[model samples]
Target: MRVMVASLAAVLLASPALAADPVQGRWITEEKDAVITIAPCGAKLCGRLSKFLVAPPQGIDQRDVNNKDASKRSRKLLGMPVLTGFVENGDEWRGTIYDPKSGKTYRSILQRKGSNQLTVKGCLGPFCQTQTWRKAG
Candidate 1:
């Protein structure tokens, strides 16, 4: 009985770590405009734009000209860390998401759907927009 109890305790203690974070991979945004790679950053998870599938809009700077911080305005959009400060919340993750298009930051939640789909939500007050992303090869 003692051995069985100890084995059960060990398994329960190790299960969370054994279940890897499903967001730790490349994902194609719902708009199919870009791919972002999610990975561990310190104790939290963050995502960065890794590739652009479509050509950037013409007649506009390819830089982060709309960023609130003037110094960051010159930074390139590609390879930018748009998702940050995410912490695990049960099966989902809560964080902040940056929209370079609008140069705004909003409360975000990311949840995995099956093994290949991820739902990304950004909320401003009672208004929230959801985008579903697919696993990228």
Candidate 2:
């Protein structure tokens, strides 16, 4: 029926663009220190620290104590969002990455390296660093 066909078309059109991108999943940092889970935050992609391979020196309750924003310094490391505001841009995702260790935020980009890898880059003007993160199990 026409009604059924129109309903199907509407559902397809309403799907998110991320359906074609495999960025939603768990990934381990290059250093194997932390695991970040990437998922949809409204219409944008965001990553949060799900676990730490190496225990924090300050213990499990470790806080973002170094954050210059005094109000945010007390935030716990676990479940803290590190990558946010990401929007798909062709082959890469453009966004900002927060470095909890340095308490700084940098303009960042995430490029799919392979089926199970991603190259994350953070830039501050002309300075930039790239890390290859493996898709976690």
Candidate 3:
């Protein structure tokens, strides 16, 4: 049983449990446009556009026509991952955020403020735009 116990301990130390991160949940965007669900994808954390609270110009079932890649243009917007490669950085998260409207991806910094608020920063060079997202009910 000693070897079995050692193996179990090693496995636990290797992979982080998803539930340990408080950011793993649904959040309302700063604009209240859509609900984003932040969850574990592969070995990292990713945030996806899960639900639309407001309809866009093309409606809820719209395709990703604004994507830079022609092949990905036909993909649907809902359930699309806007935040990818997010990993724990001290108390915050560092990741890449994709903007469907601009067809661009930016360096993103996610810092949780208080219990219900999260500050998301999308950076370009030294300039960054910040937005506050609230935990969804």
Q: What's the CA error at residue 78 for candidate 1, in Å?
A: 1.1
lDDT of 3 by residue, 21-122 (tens): 357889999999999999999989999999999998899888889899999998999999999999887778999999998889999988888789988899
Per-model C-alpha lDDT, please? 0.89, 0.91, 0.90
What lDDT score goes with residue 74 in model 3? 88
Work out how many backbone clashes candidate 2 has.
0
* Backbone clash numbers for all candidates listed: 0, 0, 0
TM-scores of all predicted structures: 0.82, 0.83, 0.83
Model 1, residue 92: C-alpha shift (Å):
0.7
Query: Relative to the unseen true structure, what is the C-alpha lDDT of residue 74 in candidate 2, on a scale of 0 to 100?
Result: 90
Q: Model 1: per-residue lDDT, tens digit, 46-125?
A: 99988888767742237888899999998888889999999888778999999998999999999988889999999999
lDDT tens digits, residue span 8-126, model 2: 99999998665235578999999998999999999999999999998888987899987889999999989999999999887789999999989999999998877899889999999
Better of 2 and 3 by lDDT: 2
In candidate 1, where is summed lDDT lowest over 10 consecutive residues? 14-23
Q: Which stretches of candidate 2 lie over 4 Å from their true place?
A: 1-20
Q: What is the model-wide C-alpha lDDT for candidate 1?
A: 0.89
- lDDT score of model 3? 0.90
| lDDT, ranked from best to worst | 2, 3, 1
